[model samples]
Target chain A: MRYFTTTVDLKDSELDHSIYVQCLQLRREVFISQMGWNLYQHMGCEFDQYDTPASVHVVALQNNAVLGCMRLLRTDNDLGNATYMILDAHLGRIPNLPSGIMDEQIQSQDTWEASRLAISSRVPTSERNAVLVDLLRTGMEYVATRGGTSLLGMMNPVFLRVFRRAGLRAYKFGRIADQRDGRLCVMKLDLEPGAAMVAA
Target chain B: MKHPIQEKFNKYGFVILAPGQVPSDAITTFSDEWKEVYFRNEFHKIDPVFEFAVRSTRNSNCTLLSEAQMTNELFEEARMFEADSNFVSVSHYGGNTMVFGGVNPELDPRATASIQHACQATHRIELLKNLDLLTDTQIDLMEMAEEGFLDKEIASEFGISLSAIAQRKQAICKAVGTDCFKSTLRLYTLQKWGGLVGEYT
Candidate 1:
């Protein structure tokens, strides 16, 4: 019931490693065992390569139990950029991708493009919604503080519904494809500076 | 025309018209219109029988189940062969009980009333306990507010007049000691959940 917002690294040492394992276990329970999502099962862990150096990990816990977790990757990362490029193939045409929160840090010389986000399904519904609200607020605040123009990403249609409910305008990208988890539609949200700042 | 079937529907939530008992033309026309809307919205996954149950019981002032209502039975049969099918196959009869009566079956009036009362009592109790920051009437008003029900709707639902409902709502707000309705609701929810606000780890 106690709530604390700290970066993943800050909680890393104090965190119960067993909770992390349970988080992964819960992910497997929902995604692999139940829904039969084939993408992460081969990874040995519920995590993927985008989880490495450039991702900001957020965790929600209650009484030392990791209830939920999400990963935010800077668009400049190798795996992160690849998401947008691959989306272009599904889209059948490329469109101008917007800059993400870490554009300045990642694309100091070149133009930055899109942020990648991955959210875990361990959290309860209400808490999950709250976490997403906080995520959008924090991301926008970070962009505003750094004088960034906008933010963009490729995300699943389900999560896109959440974003739209939170008052963000999202455009569906790419043709719907049948994944192991039913049909998925790619989507993008353009976070305007003023609006993003207010949201933050 | 004062149809006996319509009177039965008004008294009870549902009615069943036997085959050739009611005019099929009206039902067919209604069904066709509903199908257009359902398929247009990509809600074809919904079982047709269940749809008929809802439409006949909730929407229509008439109660009837025909042989064509057996389409839901076929849908169930078809879904059983699918690999990832967890369709809600049976009709829910309030609380957690599932009734086997699909197209046509005897209805239990007492069981239905008992279920309805139990659900209302449960909802009222939970709402009162959760809204500790507000009075019972205030909690009721808050629920109505959340639902965006009009004053008349709220009054009719609670068996009170429009003016009485508004006065009670205002008084409840005063008792809650908060000018902002949303903040009061949030605080009440927080208190109900052990007063741990925004403390997600």
Candidate 2:
């Protein structure tokens, strides 16, 4: 099953211990152990500043195992001031973004950013593919329900091609140079509210 | 390909397709080759990932298929694409399916929703691409309309008359084939004019 849990919605004390722990384990396996991303290297589970109060985590699970996960942060929350998108968090300066990249004023409330996308490598090969799609389904369903109109985040090149191929009205925002993960670029996926893609 | 998108597939190990290309029989793999799979092999119907992806379009909620679906031969073949590492993202919009995923190392679910929204919006744009949906002034006005800008607020932001705004909106709706400009905005919240170049600036 797939659903969302936010620091705002579910208290840390009330967390489903098994699922939450699995999320941390999955992060460790995907980000640290497998990918060698040092930033996520922690005491067997990866946690960061972005996992603050009011942060949303969309998780997918099957057969009692954590399938995949991602995090969404609402800038309107108090912690939002603590950590914004790649702009304030990594880049330190917002790009002279194209007009619809999102208004500086409106982004605070209506726009939320996604990060920490990870999938466990331990699942059996046959089930791995289906689990990945489950994660996306859960995450987007969460955003749509929250009244989100756009997603602003950073991605590397390989997945960027996937988004374009997937038909996301994805556009270039800017580039993040001098990062450990090569050069990361800014991307935006604009949403159409209540408009479904009908075959012409 | 754009840096961010490629990195997502590399980092997360998955990709999604636009609505127009979903139905194509060609499936891409981590090695960047489009393999010709007979899509009618019935695996898509029984595959939980495929079913959940299609269900994601109709409802704004994520649907998780039962664990039993992983045992199917078709999904088994797809999983074996990259040695059981990455899977493709197959998303549907309106009625069209944009089937893409199974690239990189391991596909993550967090990218799915963002990918689906992006795919649908971009697909919507492609459908309206020929219509010249927005004039220069109209585009400017629409940007103002974002972030809860009302007609009055947009008019004030653009320093234009409300009637002018109304007329511009009418033209946009007429051009884009939406019932009204509001609906067009709901479906085609476009930021870039050029269709998915898949490259970094």
- lDDT of candidates 1 onward, in order: 0.41, 0.50
Please give fnat for model 2: 0.00
After superposition, candidate 2 runs with Cα above 4 Å error? A1-9, A12-15, A40-42, A93-106, A123-134, A176-178, A195-200, B1-201
Q: Over 4 Å off in model 1, which ranges?
A: A9-26, A40-44, A79-127, A139-161, A174-180, A192-200, B1-201
- lDDT tens digits, residues A157-187, model 1? 3445456556776666554443322233445
TM (chain A), candidate 1 = 0.57
Highest-scoring model, TM-score? 2
Which residue pairs clash within candidate 1?
Answer: A2-B199, A3-B199, A3-B200, A60-B201, A61-B201, B17-B64
Predicted complexes: DockQ each: 0.02, 0.02
Q: Model 2, range A138-183, lDDT digits (tens) per residue?
A: 4555566677666666654333433553455667665433243233
> What lDDT tens digits, residue by residue, belong to model 2 across residues B52-128?
66665554333223346445666477565542323434433333344444334333566666655553443453434
Question: In lDDT terms, which candidate is top?
Answer: 2
Q: Docking quality tier of candidate 2?
A: incorrect
